[model samples]
Target: MSNRSRPDSAGSPRGSDEAAQGPGVSAGTAPVGTVLVVLHQARSTPGRIGARLQRRGYGLDVRRPALGEDLPQTLDGHCGVVVFGGPMSANDPHPFLREETVLLERALARSVPTLGVCLGAQLMARALGARVDGHREGVCEIGYYPLEATPAGAALLPWPDHVYHWHSEGFDLPEGAELLATGRTFPHQAFRYGMNGYGLQFHPEVTREMMAAWTERGAHRLTHPGAQPAEAHFSGFDRHDGAVCRWLDAFLDAWLAAAPLK
Candidate 1:
């Protein structure tokens, strides 16, 4: 099922190679490719990341299998795929999620650049043969937190001191995946599973509006054991928003540059 929303018009048409040199597009700096954005729910759409990518001259093909749209069988025409977070567990017995996992596996096998956020990251972990489930340890992570980057993470992208997070479950680092960032509650905060695939446990794509919607909708879950209050997540967003946005811009630029052209 597809959402009524469409890709930003500022971006060139999806998957057009000539878009790289199109008028108003930055010569040589912009990445020319269409990103296949997989949405699990209405609230967990790409948000800020989609806006940033449009400004960077990349088109987005948004799809929602939960709404009846078919998940692409191959990463044949797109340059990359990004799976956004949602409330559902990666292990949920949902047909759409099963299909999403398979699509992620195919994306990696084809060397297409792929990124996963929160539950999306968990899905990637499962696709790569790693374990993902609710936080077994009595602790759940919610709100803003700090991340200590590994040497590999620092070399790959600009690692901010802190990032906005709103997740209760985490995943074990997939086999052969490079550990990029770590947090106190969940050691596996970020990872790179393949040459072009990344998984982030936090919501780097979140904007203030997105956070508001989530906190309002999931207010009941915020009271879960060890879960931080909504205010805790909102109050600190201002302090970290600038740095996180900067890091996201740089990260997306690098990620898109690495995507193999189809």
Candidate 2:
């Protein structure tokens, strides 16, 4: 798969070459701390989230533990952690998954700023001793769906009416975790474990190009019981993407502000 186009801070399309460079230090300034980005696939990039972090002046230290890349034993020198979603389940017996869960556990223990998306969210829930499993009816959420912010979530920030989803499984809200957002099929859309840790089941990081690629390559997923038609995905993007992007910007700001770099 080709590297998906991402938007720069100015909202212009950035080429794959530029995106491939990842986040780096600006010309003369000493670096703001780095955020450890954990991705599951070889070709996977952090998409909008990485770009947002770069614009905020934090360098990205991208790691793919699935491909034998080793994660740091600690979050030393790291300001935050973002674990992106993937095809693998958090319940899988893969050693890398176990390693990541352990790392997430440690990060939470240290009160490190952490954001988990989709499978990443599931991993966070697992680390907190919550169960991650498929729906009893076997329904999946493969496209855009309605999202309602709970009273607790609305107090933090406004949310988009609908958000993109692509998962067969959902996680139970772990003990002590606050449910931030909700959906029909997957009730637990977003949650906060502590002041610094967040888990979102939807993909606010998805860009238009990423959506196109996902729909094409994973077309079969649309046939699932609760999945949306491929065309609806594009329509949903046109109608809801602006709100989602705004929400992401606000959320990232709040997330970083929640914990000062240690």
List candidate 1 segments past 4 Å from native.
Answer: 1-31, 260-262
lDDT of model 1 at residue 29?
A: 62
Name every residue pair that clashes in candidate 1.
1-67, 1-68, 1-69
What CA root-mean-square deviation does each model show from the true structure?
6.8, 4.9
Q: After superposition, how far is residue 24 of candidate 2 from its true place, in Å?
A: 5.8
Q: Write the residue-wise lDDT of candidate 1 on 23-78 in tens digits.
A: 33355664577789987754345767776766767777889886688977767778
* Backbone-clash count (model 2): 0
* Predicted structure 2: lDDT: 0.83
State the RMSD for candidate 1: 6.8
Best by TM-score: 2
- Tens digit per residue, CA lDDT, model 2, 1-262: 1111111111113454224245556778765778999987756778888888877778889899988999998788798999988887788889999999999999999899999999899999999999998889988888899999999999999999999888888899999999999999889999998899999999888888777767777776678788888899999999999999999999999898889653
| TM-score to native of every candidate shown | 0.85, 0.91
Clashing pairs in 2: none
